[model samples]
Target: MMPSPYPLEKDLGMRYYASDSPGIGGRLRSSPEDFVVEELPLPISDPNGPYLICRLTKKNWELQQAVKEIAKHLGISHRRIAWAGTKDKNAVTTQFISIYDVTPEAVGLVRIKDILLEVVGRSQHPLSLGDLAGNRFDIVIRDCNPEELAKRVQAATEAVSAGVPNYYGLQRFGVVRPVTHIVGEEILKGNYEGAVVTYIGRTYPLETETAQRARRNFAETRDARAALADLPIQMTYERAMANHLVANPGDYAGALRVLPPKLLSLLVSAFQSYLFNCALSSRIDAGFSLTEPEVGDRLLFANGREDIVSSRNRQAALMQIRRGRCRIALFIPGSEPMASHGPMDEIMQDLMEKSGITAEDFERASRFVETKFAGTLRAISLSADVQADISGESVRLRFTLPPGHYATTVCREFMKADPYVMI
Candidate 1:
């Protein structure tokens, strides 16, 4: 196993790379255009539907913020806007969104800087997350070492083509402050107060000194009003939580509930993702091959059904994996009771025990967030048909990843640099 050199990555359970090649040292997203993402959405067809489907193209913009800007221009609540995927703010991203009760003329009239919204079609249903088939990425990495570049690219490409551990990217947690999982742990442990405190008061070194000072003051004094005075207006979500605390003292759960339901759900989901990362890494650390299953592994088929590898089906599962029929997957625990079936489940159970979490805790979280914490399966590994090109001191990668996969996971195998470089 090639352990990651970055400390932040290690903290997040992304501890190793599938490829061992000395990476072609480079940086990603030197500019917005350098990292392009085009969503492959599922078909949307309804000529006279209530929801207007618009293709949103933006450069260097956050999806939520961009949606809020569009909502402001349209004089509607941002809740009316829905998207399939949440895209990074630092890239050129084009994806579809559904705006309810809005016409194409109104959408066309509304515009923001570096943001293009076009009415593509109409849908009876509002778009939800994971509505896309996949996303195509055209990324350029700049300032790479030229010596032995081809050799390193060849090695990394081969490894990535075979498969790479499908760990969630840095963006799953806050890029500037990776405290989402920490907040989640607090939530699952039934410490709503700790969750609120962590969400509002935890400061990262990457954040500005003023932001850090504000958070520290809040942490030290537990004074929500004082924090409000120092907290930047741009810290909208944090400020909202702090304001809630000021109005209703000692209601940490209420403070958390003040956040957008989607954001609150994500805070808990991040913890599930972190556990999956750890289980994947532990599987590799136990000398198990990613694609090949042993007697106690779980197999996830393309159709979303699951089966356990057994003495009777181990060979069959191996053949199925080789033929692209299914992949090994790990479970993300939730409110529903899922009986332990295999080694993967055992790993998760151990993790839950160690973390002081249980199915009941997830039930409490589900009630608090108003989103079902029902469990799901994630592929343990992913492979992409990579196209690599080089010009002068840069390298470009073109590939498409299925919905829910991260392009940075592929890029990391090639670059193998600090996570901040990719961010």
Candidate 2:
């Protein structure tokens, strides 16, 4: 029988390459102003293209809602709008979005509460994922003792210089419900119907009382009809799936189809991230340094393949590290091509077997519905331009990280507190 899945929470099972330090207890995201992010878009040539790019700054707005609003005002489908990346829902963020043939007059007409949009320029090519060099962050951590905070900061600085493990931020998985991966695991097991149940009926102990009751009732009775009333009306995806199940009864696969393709893709991707986290943690436990590259480890910026010819492979991989040209990384299993050598390979394979998967599942899982995945590289450590300042009861941190790396992971190295407690 399979072991019970690990609980998803802030910092649960995450590995820390930096040595632990005493944390100065503080609260993050005390307000939207406390966290700020701006995209560092890739360099562009002349703005002589068919695509209209806008620099949008949003405060306390979710990306999906903001996209839908822009689409409505522009008289186009949501799919017509494209962005380099998604920003935090509860953060102050600015990023570029490219829409084909959009007029400034139409952009001015967009009115999402707390969202501000501006037409930056025109581009021939739409900004796709990983188009940014990184993100710049300005953050404030409040209510920490000055003395302890300084020590923590000093420790964090050393860790930063040495490189901290680039673990996924707590926000990678939902903070409140943390069920994206749970639903994904069921999907991987070929239980389409079970995925719906897990989404609607699974409850965590830390969840709100109302949510707990709703999920517990559904889990016990397995009745979509009853759960619909119990689930908050704001849960449109859950409500849609439940409504379908209530009417169609056992059409599990159809129920899974209720979510939009982008959202559906996110669920599967989140699961892959979860496994990546586990694999990285395993490698750390076996004594890999976040700062150094080893013979068997794949690099973030290196082109990887199934056949890793041995002769110059180790020398080439290590050369990138020596020049700090590559970020350390682990592969998220799925139709993605990957190669691991030495102890790390054994560790990853062990994790696969424990999860009821063979080494082949890495490539086999790409066929699942809405589960589009390809082998990709992600850095396990990052290089950042960080600055810290102290003012009264708060510590202000400013930095820029490479694309796909999270600022929260950097903060975790210093705080060393339960993600909930620190943030």
Candidate 3:
């Protein structure tokens, strides 16, 4: 059984903090150039190996798009290339990518727009997601009132040091279409047809009028031939699905199967993220301390250990937390043994009853392992150290966060505004 879908909800606003924080009221990522991220890998690069490690600095290019272009240039299959993780397209991002059976010199001849690829080294194994320790972010906020930014950032930065609730930020879901979770919901319910339609149609206010026109036409007609003409060539997945269905005719599941397995996994993971966000929001609503564990509360540590809260050990746990030894985390349910307590426990119970997803259900996973929803613990709060620099009307915020964490989480505390518009 697939996990039950969380509500196809709007932004689950700030958690473990109130909305009354003063607004920095600045805009971020006005241009792709405004945000920069550099991967700080775990010093694991090996120079003597069969794998080619390449440093990629891509400006305004999606991570996968960059990989595709690199593969075409190097004359290698994209499947053989690997990376620590993905970076957002709407930024100047840099990360190390690895390819198998390639020499360092052969990897250097690749070229793409706004992309600089250099052979960094050779590693014994291809890098996989979560292989990195963290990423360093340089973000610029524009059109700000300097005094307001200074005041807001100061307070926000101090709050960040105390700890920022580790909710998955808006980018995890589609910012414009906002239908990733919707499609995820359909998949979990075993509605592949619904998933395909939700992904292809279901236009929203945030989407461009041009895109809405094409998608709406496709949705109403279900004509792959017409859709191919209407949709731009850039909608590769949509086009591929259309081509597949044009021949297969109403084979929705097979059409969905045409997508890359990694993408299918992302759809499921998005739903998991949605549920995690909801649980965190509920905990905050109940006015529970994210850092301070109370009796009957369950805790997850950074070193991948679990603990149960008891008065005898709660204080000791708090001390360990302050010393950066442990954190509070919620489980993403899978076909594995796990448990939770306190406000998080209530949220999970509610979600479980609502979603109808049980641990055993995860055993009946999709063909791909990534879609397994194999439960894992995630931190509820992060001890982020945000460094804010105010220069006239523009502010530059710099910070480093653990892998799988979003920098926008720190900025949202200061922005106190809608992510769709401001960031």
Candidate 4:
């Protein structure tokens, strides 16, 4: 008999597959020829250039902090410096940042040791949000197979050439399913206070079924009621409704389409949480943590210095900056890709078939490959290097993914590893 599906467990399983395995055709460790890493540079500015744009490479620095440092050096506010998006701090990232109201003379004034600030190009208009196309990434892979490697490379190249689905990457939400659960719980308790608190506190756990149920309920409610109606409506309920409306403007028709009031509230809450989670994920990917102004110093930027932001601040910031246009793609690896086909492979195969995906889809999900390496600090080291020849050994892959997709979804089919870190 087939086992009853546990959504949470299934989610965890998918994560294991994506992170632990290599490729779909049993190519665990790549030989020299099989391993390949390439970076695609994204378009920053248009051809017409009078605008002072700089493409600098920073070694071991967070993108946001780099922006702030550059702003301070140039004697400009952080808001003035604009970039396409944020990059991970641990990895050496080369990106473009523009300083408006600065000339070629002033561009030369900024200096930082790790950061190399130069004028890539310039334009009359300042670089604003969503100003450029996607970023181009340069990646390096280690260990590869010359023969089979060619096929794998062809597959990856083809996939990217065809636009990959822009789903939210997992980094947007807390590891696994914490954000969903927290929002769910808050909605069910009718506790706007708790929901607000959780957004600020970042204290929600990943495995709360109650919270998940609440979130589901909220989604149902919003589906029912199109607008916020008054029947002795409290301020908290009104605010919650307002938040729901902002997060899900498209759902208004759907909310109105439903008839019952109870159902309407639930749907509104669900859509609200979804929007909130999406925004939160984007900010976190950009290196901001959750925080609350009311909490003051407890959850401020000062407290979230180590690449960890408060859930509250992250979610609130998301609400403030969300444009409902962000999209992401999560890459997960499977066992077949690692070349270790066993009983586990059969189980994963069944799951994949049921999910309407093939083994190839899992293998080619992302160009980045993650291998498990033994290290002193008990860390999950991510490298862009691919090891295709060594079919049995594990390797690490590092790539910058957009917000709202799960890294683990790529490795759940492989063995479980501790100390999984995504930066």
Total backbone collisions, model 1: 0
C-alpha RMSD in Å of predicted model 3 compared with the true structure: 4.0
Q: Could you tell which candidate, 2 or 3, scores higher by TM-score? A: 3
Model 4 CA deviation exceeding 4 Å by range:
1-51, 128-133, 136-166, 174-196, 204-419
Better of 2 and 3 by lDDT: 3
Over 1-423, each residue of candidate 3 has an lDDT whose tens digit, in order, gives 011122233354233343345667678889988899999977755788878787889988877767878888889888788899788888999898888898767766665779998887788898988899899999998877566566777888888888877878777776666666667767776777888887786787766787788899888888877877877788788888888888998888888877766676777777778788888777776777778786777677777788877889988988988888888778776657556556577677678679876655455544433455678778888767778888887888889998999888777776665566544
Highest-lDDT candidate = 1
Angstrom error of the Cα, residue 152, model 2: value is 1.8
Residue 149 alpha-carbon offset, candidate 4, angstroms: 12
The models' CA-based lDDT, in order, is 0.91, 0.72, 0.75, 0.37
lDDT of 4 by residue, 1-423 (tens): 011133443232212121212333222212322221222334544646545677767776655567767878878776677665444444465666667767767768777887777777766666543344433333333334334455545443333222222222333333333354343334333444444334322323452554444444444453213323321232233335435544665443322322223222332223223333333333333332222111111211211121212444555533422332111211122324422223222433343355443434323221111212111000011112222222333233334332222233222222122213222
**Candidate 3 Cα deviation (angstroms), residue 224:** 2.8
* Model 3 alpha-carbon drift over 4 Å, by segment: 1-19, 337-343, 368-371
Candidate rank order under TM-score: 1, 3, 2, 4
Model 1: residues >4 Å from true position, as ranges? none
By summed lDDT, which 10 consecutive residues of candidate 2 come out lowest?
A: 1-10
Candidate 2 regions off by >4 Å? 1-12, 44-50, 301-320, 336-340, 358-371, 421-423
Error of 3 at 38 (Å): 0.7
> How would you encode candidate 1's per-residue C-alpha lDDT over 242-328 as one tens digit per residue?
999899999988999888778888899999999999988888888888888988777889888888889998999999999988999
Model 4 lDDT on a 0 to 1 scale: 0.37
